[model samples]
Every structure is written in C-alpha cells, then in structure tokens.
Target chain A: MSEHTVRAYDRDLEALDRKISEMGGIAEKMLSDAMDALSTFDVALAQQVVATDQRLDVLQREIEEAAILTIARRQPLAVDLRECIAAIRISGDLERVGDLAKNIARRATELVDEARTLRAIIGLKSMHDLAALQLKEVLDAYAQRDAERARAVWLNDADLDALEDSVFRDLLTFMMEDPRNISFCTHLLFCSKNLERIGDHTTNIAETVVYLASGAPMPTDRPKTRSFGQAEEKP
Target chain B: MSEHTVRAYDRDLEALDRKISEMGGIAEKMLSDAMDALSTFDVALAQQVVATDQRLDVLQREIEEAAILTIARRQPLAVDLRECIAAIRISGDLERVGDLAKNIARRATELVDEARTLRAIIGLKSMHDLAALQLKEVLDAYAQRDAERARAVWLNDADLDALEDSVFRDLLTFMMEDPRNISFCTHLLFCSKNLERIGDHTTNIAETVVYLASGAPMPTDRPKTRSFGQAEEKP
Candidate 1:
C-alpha cells in the first residue's frame, strides 16, 4: 500500500475508535442514571436515560458502517484486521448495554405508584455500581490497549454474580414480607438482572480487548458464581 | 476481479450462510426445549439445553472469525459486504437467543420442588409459540432473502409484547393468590421476559435480513406494544 493509503487507513480506524469511546461514555452514563432513577423513583430521569439510548444506537450503526467500509477499502490484514473487527464487536456490546439501561430505566416509571422498597433498591444499587465500574474499566482497557486491565475486568465478573445472588434473596424476602411488594420487588428483580447482563456485556468487551491486543480468543467458560435466572440458591 | 476470485468469494459467503442456518436451527430447538422443560419442570432437558448453548457460542465465534478473514482476503464490495455483515449480526442474535433459552431452562431446575402453577405456564406457552414462530419465519426470511417476510416478522413483534402484558397480569394474580407462589411466579416472570427478548432478537434478525436483501437500514423505532421490563399496564 502507498503511504497515502496507509495514512487514510489510520484515519478510518481512529474514527471508529472515537465513535466507540463516545458510545462507551453514553452507555456508562445511561447505566448510572437508570440506577439513580430506580432508587429515587425519578420517572423523569428514567425517561431521560431511555431517550439517551437512541444516541448510542445511532453511534453503533455509524461505527459498524464505518468499520465495514474500512475493511472494504483498506483490506487490513492480521492485527489491523482484528482491530476493525474488534471495533465492530465492542460497539455491539456497548449498544446492548445501552438497551439494558433503557430497559432498567423504563421500569422506574412503573414503580412510581407501587410502594417504595428502599432496601431492595440498595442491593440493586450495589450491583449497578459494580457493573458500572466494570464497564468503565473495560472501556478504558479498550482505549489503552491494556490487556491486563481487560483481563481483570473479565475475571471479576463473578463478584457481580455473587452480588446478584444476595440481591435475589433480598428481593424475594421483600416480596414475601408484603404481597404489595411483589409487584414492586419484581421490577427490581428485573433491574438487577439487567445489571447482571451489563456485567456480562462488560466482560464481553474485555474479551474483545484481549483479542484485539493479542490475536487469540479467551477461554469460553467464565468463572460461574451461579447460573443466572435461578430464583433461589440451591438447597 | 477474476472469475475464480468471484467464485471463491461466493463460497466464503455461502459458508457463512450455512453456519448461520445451523446456528438458527440450534437456537430454535433450544428455545423450544427450554419452554418444554419449564412447563414440565424437566431438569434433565433444561440441562441439555444449557449444554447445547456451548455449540451455538462456538459457531458464533467461528462465523465472526470467518467473516473477518473473508473481508481481509476477498475484500468483498457492495452487496457481498452486506451479506458478510448480516451473517455476523444474525449469528449474534441467534447466539443471544441460545443464551436466553438456556436462561429459561436454568430456571426450570429451580422450579422442581415449588408448587406447580400450570395456569401460568399456559400463558407463557402462548408467548413461546409466538416467539418460536417468529424465529422460524425470520430464519426463513434470512435463508430465502425474503424482505417482505422479514418485514412481517418485524411488524408482528408487537403481538408478543401484548402477550407478555397479559402474562404479566396473570402471574401477578397468582403471586397475590398465594405467597408460596411468589418464588415460582417470579421465575415465570423472567421466563416470559426471556420469551419477549427472543421476540426482540427475532426482529433484529428480521432487520438484518432486510438489510442483507436491500443494503438499507431499517427505521430505529419498532412498533412497541408496551415498553419492555414494565411490571404492569399503565393506569
């Protein structure tokens, strides 16, 4: 390739990276705001979180299109090829994070009329904080090409899963304490699940980072604290 | 491009398509079996579904790696490029479908000792049937490149949402009817949500089909019957 073509390829990749960072920032904020909305029953904030997801969606589409064009035009090989593919993969995980946040936030409006369960929200908030932190770390890892940081985020997802188990028990107790809490607690349950999924997406990003840095896939099996979607701990 | 090169590109695209179809078959069966496991409390069947998800994951990674390598080697343009991108996107959707199905199946083990709410399962059955049908239709659309059929799947997602609404109300009623039902019904709630998400993924696949056929992106806003993750109908 000519020097000019090489420079153009660098510019294309930089553009894709910039868009992914922008998407990461938006997705992180959405997760934080959605948790706040849930905890405070701030319907307006939740609605804002829902609205912000559109930007992430648009950015993801742009990144994907640009990445494809880069591949077509540049025909990058080896590591360059992997970077473009990583951009596409990471953008996808970030986009789903935005969707999960929107889903969490959308539940806030439903809880406005239901009896408040502040304690239940506390557990979900912890889950949110961990998920948000993991997301941030993974994005940083991606930006820095820090495979170690990404691997740390990858290994630490079990902590989030453990938190979810406790939260699950707490919410179940809240529901049992008052049947009225059933409807309200159920929404929190889903919110926690959403948070857990965010952690999953974060780990997905971390793996992508690892792959981008070193052209090899991570081990498929993550350390399992528990299989998700179970309502209770095993007896 | 040489005729031989063009033929090789076609072969690459065809290989991607075959992998995607195989994934669709596995995911569709997983969804069906998971629901069956949930309704019957079949722990072994659910375990089988969980194990099957590994195959889908492997296929997704293979498809992605192959797609990227194809771009690096063939540098496909226009419609060929879109086909490769569509395969990546559809495999992703299908892989998530497998995960969601595995999630649903995982809950079946939890419900083994709980009091059976066969009535609640009936409502979820309707949802599963609709989601399964949509999955089948969207895969058909993708396989045949039937844009009209894909559009129909995209439009029909609202029906799944409506079914979820009814299912939500029924589960709530059951939880209220018996405190013992709280834990069981919560699992059902997640199951229904899983089914709803399957619908969401089906529509995603539908959109990819439309794009693959026409090289045009669909509108961002789907016709939502109710925003997902909501616990009840609006007042």
Candidate 2:
C-alpha cells in the first residue's frame, strides 16, 4: 500500500462497509416486514416496505459513487481494487433485495381483499424464512469477511430453489382446484418468485464476499436445484 | 487525462467497449430467438438460447474484471473514470437481458407440449418487439454516446410497462376462462415479466450512457405506469 493511501483510503472503505451494513439491515427488516404484511394482509406495512426501498436505492447509488470516487482518488491495487468492486456488487444485490421485499409487500396490498389462501402461503412462508436467514447470514459473512460463511450461504441457496419449486407446485395446484384462486395464486406465485430472487441476491452477495476475501472468482455456475425455468436470473 | 494514461488506457477502454458490443449482439439474438422459440414452440431454439446464456455470463465477468483492471492501472479521472464505470454498469444490464431472454426460452421449452394459446401470445409479441427495439436503440445510444437518444429510450419504457399491464390482464382472463389454460397462461405471465425486465435493463443502460456522456446521473425514478408491484428490480 502507498503511504498516501493509508488513513484516507481506509476511511473511505470503512464508510462504504458501514453503508453496506446499513443497507443490509434495512433490507432484512423490509423483508421480514413484507412477509408479515403478506401473511396478515397489512397494507400499511406493505406500503412501508415500498417506501423503504427508496432509501435502499439511495444508499446503492451512494455506495457506487463512493466506490468509484475511491478508486479514482486512491488508485487501489489488487485486494483493495477487489474490495471496491465487491462493494458495488454487494450494494447492488442489497438494493435488489430491498426491491424484492417491496414486491412481496406490493403483492400483499393487491391481495388485501381476496380470500385468504393460508395453505398456499405456507410454502411461501418457508421460503421467506429461509431467504431471510440467508440474507442475514450472508450479510454477517460480509461483515466478518468470512469466505467460509459466505460459501455456506452459497451452498444453502439450492434449498431455497427447492422451496420455490414446492411453492410453485402448491400455487399451481391451488389455481387448478378452484378457478377463483387463480388471481390470488398468481400473485402468490410472484411472491414466491420474489422470495426466490432474494435468495439469489444473498447468493450473489456470498460470491462477492468470497471473492473479496480470497481475491478469486467463484465457480461460474452456482448450485441450483430446480431443473427448468430458472426463476428470472438477477433483476 | 494524465500523461501516463493515454495509449494503453484507451486500448483497455476500446477492448471493454468491443466486449460490450459482442455481449449486446449475443443478448439481442438470444432475445429474438427466444421470442421466436416461444411463438413457434421450438424446443431446439429454446435450448440454444439457454446454452447461449453461459457465453453472456462469461463476457459479463470478463468485462467487469477488465474495467477494474483499467481503473487500477490507469487511475483514470473525470470522463475516463466514468467510462470504465459505465462499461461495468452497461455490461451488467446486458448480461441480465441475456438471462431474461434465456428465461423466456426456458418457459417456451416448458410449454412445448401444451396446447398453444396464440391469442395470449399476441400482447407478448408486441412486448418482445418493443423490448428488442429498446435494447437495440439503447445500445446504439451507448455506442454513439448520445445522451438524447438514451433519454428517448428512457422515456419510452413506460410504454413497455403499459404493454406488460395489458399482457397481464389478457393472461389472467385466459386462465379464468379455462382451467386448462392456467398452466400455459402462467408461463406466459412470466415471459411477459421477463420482457418487461428487459425493458428495464435498457432503461438502466440509457441512464448509464447519459451519465457516461454528461457526467451527471439521471433522476432516481423513471416514468413507470402500472400502479402496483413493479416488475422485479434489477438483479
């Protein structure tokens, strides 16, 4: 490291790390709150989740700007360069996580007056729980710079895919059982998809963390369980 | 620009740009081919699109790494810094476009044996054409560094959103009209969503182009219609 790069560059990176952590915290809360809103059909909380997404977007922009500025100003090399790029990637993931959570909340608002399909939601609930846990653990892995932890999160994503497949089948079965369930189940299908994508963001973040820690790219293909129609790759 | 930054750095930027154009070409073909696959129920074409996505993914990683390396080696400032950053951002958008196209193709394979709903696909065809046009135009905007052209693409995205709303309503009507239509219509729903997301990626690329050319970020929100549950935010 250059002598000129010590204090100021460290501060810049620390600020970025702090901002990512903040983004992660808000994303996690928004996810859980959105799920809560969905299960209970709370429009207020759902709207809150939507509103929170703006903050996440703002943070994502800020992080990207900061990272670019740091790279330009400090001219970091090797690991430091990786760190900046990883920050951009992770912030992007977190912002998408926020968006996915907001989507779930939006679906909740749409389903407010519909008949409750509690049974259909059970599979989604499991998905939500696992995705939420993955988000939390992945963020922790980032915070700790724990590549192994990130790898674990990466490995567990296949489980989320499995859950999504189950949710897909359940929602389809519900739609088949009663024509009235079509609209509601379609919204639920999107909700399950949103959750699955959130799981994906966590996986993306995990890969970034592993790269940041090891300075090596992870394998190109992740472990995905669902056989066909990979639920909408990133964004 | 720094005295040290002229020759090699320009070559780096050119390489990045060429890779982006290559990626864009693959992505555009994948999108049109996927739509063709969907309309014709061509399983072989769908498989080809799926296989093409791996190439896009590899190109994305390469572009990202090249951008970072250029940033570190050249320590580009001002417009040059923005160029590298824009390349990274635009590559990401293109990669997602490829994935969405792959997703559309995947859905097509799933629907191969099912009874065709040519009527339901009409709106989707319109969407695919528009999204394909948007992708092409936005990429031209990037190549020419024409912010005005980029802005025009950004403004047109709302029309795509309107199209998605129409498609959604049509698919839902189909599902409601015949219980047998549920499975097919649901796949169409996802395909429409995938197209809408491709539009969003174009919007993202447009914004990146505007920033790269003008050194100013676009407004945080683009013009989007269709009130609830905005399609999955960028991955």
Tell me the tens digit of each residue's lDDT in model 2 across A122-188: 9999999999999999999999999999999999998988888888888888998998888888888
- Residue pairs with colliding backbones in model 2 are A234-B235, A235-B234, A235-B235
- Give the whole-model CA lDDT for all candidates, comma-separated: 0.86, 0.88
Docking level for model 2: medium
Clashing pairs in 1: none
Evaluate candidate 1 and give its CAPRI docking class based on DockQ: acceptable
Hey, what RMSD does candidate 2 come out at?
1.8
lDDT agreement of model 1 with the native: 0.86
lDDT of 1 at B234: 12
Per-residue lDDT for B1-235 in model 2, tens only? Answer: 5555697788899999999999999999999999999999999999999999999999998998889878877777789889999999999989999989998888888897776778999999999999999999999999999999999999999899888888898888898898888888888999998898899889999999999989999998776665543434443
Candidate 1: fnat, from 0 to 1? 0.43
lDDT for A194 in candidate 1 is 80
